[model samples]
Target: MKQSLLAARYFNTTAEEAMDGLIASATPRQYLISVQDGTSLRVRIWSEIGLEEAQMGELLDWLRGVQGDIRSIQSGSTNAHDHASVVEKWVAERHGIADLFLEQLDPTTSSKADMEPELSLGVLGGRTVMISTNTLMFSRLQEGVFGLSIAQRGSYLIEQLRRA
Candidate 1:
């Protein structure tokens, strides 16, 4: 029954404005915020947390509660938005596990030796789920400063899962 304030969502707001809202909603809790850029309806402020003191399976259950679908894009997966339906169907019907690995490559990094990559790790329906994104985009956890360890482990994990 314990959950952390992982995200404070406000569609179509700037990063600074999102921070202000986050401060108002959940003060004193340090949050890594991301704003979906451009003129479209963006997350004026979306946040996340990592390594909360919760049971292993609880995190996935919590994600389901908040991001069971697109309407619950308050937090959890980046798929909480546009990809909600696909993710929902996948989770509900237990469809092809081989189709889960996907990422949106930022055009800037489309041709680079080392790109701005972001990785997020979490449990989904008691399963270990991993996602990759650009560093400027959203993440599963509020871990901007802590990306190093997550990236290292994420790489290894993806490799292992691929082999499996």
Candidate 2:
């Protein structure tokens, strides 16, 4: 199995300091990096080739254990599209697909647009997952930030999952 580092982890340090830790951990393999302001914690973004299932597990473990400065903020996955679809499907199954679609179309319904007028977040793989700033699980991936870095909010949510 293959997996990517899809996460919104919270660090108790500054963005620069947290990035230094990430760089140290991902050494020898050159992964792209990006940084931005966060609501309570700093946000960083990066991309690299996927890792094997076991390798991904090991890496996340090290990050949560030895790398005590980092905290997993939300559930992450090797693929964003798949995770978002799963979240959507879970919602649809419970609420009915037609009701879900109607809720999305309802303008009075609160959304990310109502809160921040200048934020656009999306991920592209086999498909696109548009991230909103609202409080939904998937939307919370890009909450409380005007920039493009994807992150999540929830106390110690990352530590619980221990995988990304």
User: What local distance difference test score does each model get?
Assistant: 0.26, 0.26
Candidate number achieving the greatest TM-score relative to the actual structure: 1
CA-only RMSD, every prediction:
18.5, 19.0
| Residues 1-164 of candidate 1: C-alpha lDDT, one tens digit per residue | 01111121211122233234433443222222232444211111112322243421343343344334323332434332334333333233221121122222233555433433232222232332332222112222221111111111121101111123
Flag regions of model 2 displaced more than 4 Å.
Answer: 1-45, 67-164
Q: Please give the range of 10 consecutive residues that has the lowest summed lDDT in model 2.
A: 95-104
What is residue 59's positional error in candidate 2, in angstroms?
Answer: 1.1
RMSD from true fold, candidate 2 = 19.0
Residue 57 lDDT in candidate 1: 35
Q: Can you give the TM-score per candidate against the true fold? A: 0.22, 0.18
Clashes of each: 3, 1
- Candidate 1 segments whose C-alpha is farther than 4 A from its true place: 1-90, 94-100, 118-128, 131-164
TM-score of 2: 0.18
